[model samples]
Target: MKANKAAVLTVAEKCKNILASNWQCHLSTIKADAKGSKGEIYTSKVKYIVKRGKPYVWVPESDAHNVNAIIDERGSLAITTPFPGPLAHLLKSVQKLPSRIALTGDVVLLKEKKAQLATEKLEALILSEQKAVNELSYTVRGVLSSTNPVFTSRSENLQGLTDGGENYNIYKFDLRSCTYLSGTGGTHEIDLGELQTSKADSLAPYSAMLIDGINQSESRRRALVLFCFTYLNARVKDAYILSLDRKGTDVLGKVPNPTSNEQFQWKEFRFTFKEEAPDVEALCCQLVEMEEEAIKKVSSYSGLG
Candidate 1:
């Protein structure tokens, strides 16, 4: 029989180890100042390196000045330490002592509380980044689908129908350096550099048109569904995000049945500046052709009626 394998250490432990051996925690302290303005007094030397799964703060109790300063700042004994070096040397040291060894007063409690809060925050950041990515995936799927159904939740497969007007500002590019990434600012690692969303202060109204292409042979109301696709660009028309549009339609194609071949014939419309005439002209021409075909379909339906 094969031998049993050891259970892996939890994600928190892994993250802790990563944080301990590498990331430096910056602790700020407010102190009374002579100039009447509040001054922050911090230590450059009180840094700690992660040593063998343990936080090794170098501001030892042996140093009277550092020790007193730590005590004075927190009103309890707390030493500040940033990650210094590797941890292999302190493996035996960690196993022998309690998880933490505090020589000072209420410092241990504060440190422990901080550690707990940090862990919870890290988990929250993970959730936030996951949410952003999940939303992005849905947006991509919306662009690819034959009909874009406005979904209620970011993850739910359910779709909803909406008038084309309310859909413009739904999918937005939030342009701010919100600090919850990596282990710091917001943890969304979407580093879309250089091509950031425009900060232009212009009053241009976005247009939306819903076209239910005429083919009334199918008896079901949901059977005939037309999807709207919007190509978005922050800088110029040539540049495109993978999915820069909201799922603005609620037409889920036939399911399970192999024979249902419902095709969506779309009438495209676009807006562009007159200065960029060449690209704008091409887009307009395409729209005209698409509109002509849509008109022909409408005329045929009129003739049948």
Candidate 2:
């Protein structure tokens, strides 16, 4: 586990969440010449699904990368989380980079039964996200539908992706080594076993909705900024939850320049939960408690009854 324990997730867990959250990845393979000596590397953007912590992708049988991968099973995948849905506003800062992972692995073609399973997993992933988005608040749904390309571009074309059947070849990426780049935590090398044993954050699917709701609510936003000011000792001009997991919340704060009030800079801060929340209900309760604690601390600091 290369990730710091104080952080919300381990490097491996973050890798799992990132893989589960996004469908598109850059697939890199080596094309060998007639003598199979030095080869040319080719990278192609392709849709993918993560099943059991392994990435699976499908491409037309004749695709150059596919053909290259067939000749040499060694390949790699670079995946990054898509633009966050309605909460994009919170992550607009340059400090708020995307979570990404680069995986070096053996890309082996899946046969009959394995291919069927991989295909089904891809279909299920698309359907599950659609259903989950549908259950979100109307505002989040509307914003996601219009502004988020991840959903807007793929939702309608999902059927076409899997319908290619015989024309597409399914391949599973067997992880050899992984490197995780945390948006704020820097980069770390993750072991294969560590990644294979870890699970995606339980709150991953609902993170956008939860963060967006807090950002949209005046009281919640006020409480969050106040918490940063009072507890974290941050001179915050404004603050919002950048991301959330069962382990904690990452807050992005805008602070006015010490020399010039008109100028501001962005900084990221982490607040780990006392205990991991098991579900949305528990997470909400923890957030409420945090808000209450912040309010109380603010009142005490100001000597107000």
Candidate 3:
């Protein structure tokens, strides 16, 4: 093996595969299928990486981020796995390499199947978790789809620190009408379900974080359950709310918790729900209103209007 046959073969096959099937590597050359009506195309610099003893090559950059997703989304393909070379050695051994390796149709098909399977698995996990969280909180809160929630300007493609587009707008509803009892209160306050309660039932497997406020003997006392996504992003996951009884409860975990007095002190978390996007001043004003709403909900069950 002049140059480590195993590694070289692996890399060669990968480069060949990239040259064969992937859309990113479909180069425009003097060869056939290289010309459109005008006959010119942009060049792409696609590369491969070798880690440990294995070599892997797929799409690069943004395309790579969603490469598998693209393949799996197509229903006709009915993919069950991802492309083979990118897989670990165990899976690599199981693959039945294509009869015509140059064309790379078999590898492409495998990639498609892998993507499809991964997509299905992710979807199933999310749905199952959602159902569990939803059912658990049905009696205490409401979770609404964040697709186009309220008046927040949504841009799915934009990546920013303040952007919430990638995340669905989660809203919590506590029909009790008391602001504090409705989680953060205010229209902007979405339900995280019942994240706090006696830990006796065992919510450890739920994927989201739990809140355990101190209490004499209520088992779980108070809690502010959050969705899985929120649980993972907390720099300081802390939440605080005051019940209508004026019992002050604060949750200190990942994100900042809402604050309120125990009795007659709950204002709502205000949100700007408008037909058009709010200006900076308007957004601030809306948040003010949201806080007021939260206050009202927490302070008086009858003052929701």
Kindly list the per-residue Cα lDDT of model 2 for residues 1-305, writing each as its tens digit: 11257646777887887776566789989976555625678888877767777788877676787667657889999987555543465566364667789999898998899898877876887687666656755544432333333343344335567665547888888888999987766989998888889998755655555666666566676777887876678878777777677887777788877789699877777887877887655677777788788888888878993
What is the C-alpha local distance difference test score of each model? 0.25, 0.72, 0.23
lDDT of 1 by residue, 189-215 (tens): 222242122111110000000111111
Q: Candidate 1 — which residues are off by over 4 angstroms? A: 1-14, 23-27, 32-45, 49-54, 60-184, 187-305
Candidate 2 lDDT score at position 114: 87
TM-score for each of the candidates? 0.19, 0.76, 0.19
**Models sorted by lDDT, best on top:** 2, 1, 3
- Error at 49, model 2, angstroms: 1.7
Those runs of model 2 whose alpha carbons end farther than 4 Å from true positions after fitting are: 1-7, 32-38, 60-62, 85-96, 126-160, 163-167, 208-223, 258-262, 292-305
Looking at model 3, residue 88 earns an lDDT score of 22
- lDDT per residue for candidate 3 within 166-196, as digits (tens), equals 3211111112111111122222221223212
> Candidate 2 or 3, higher lDDT?
2
Which residue pairs in model 2 clash with each other? Answer: none
Candidate 2: Cα lDDT at 190: 91
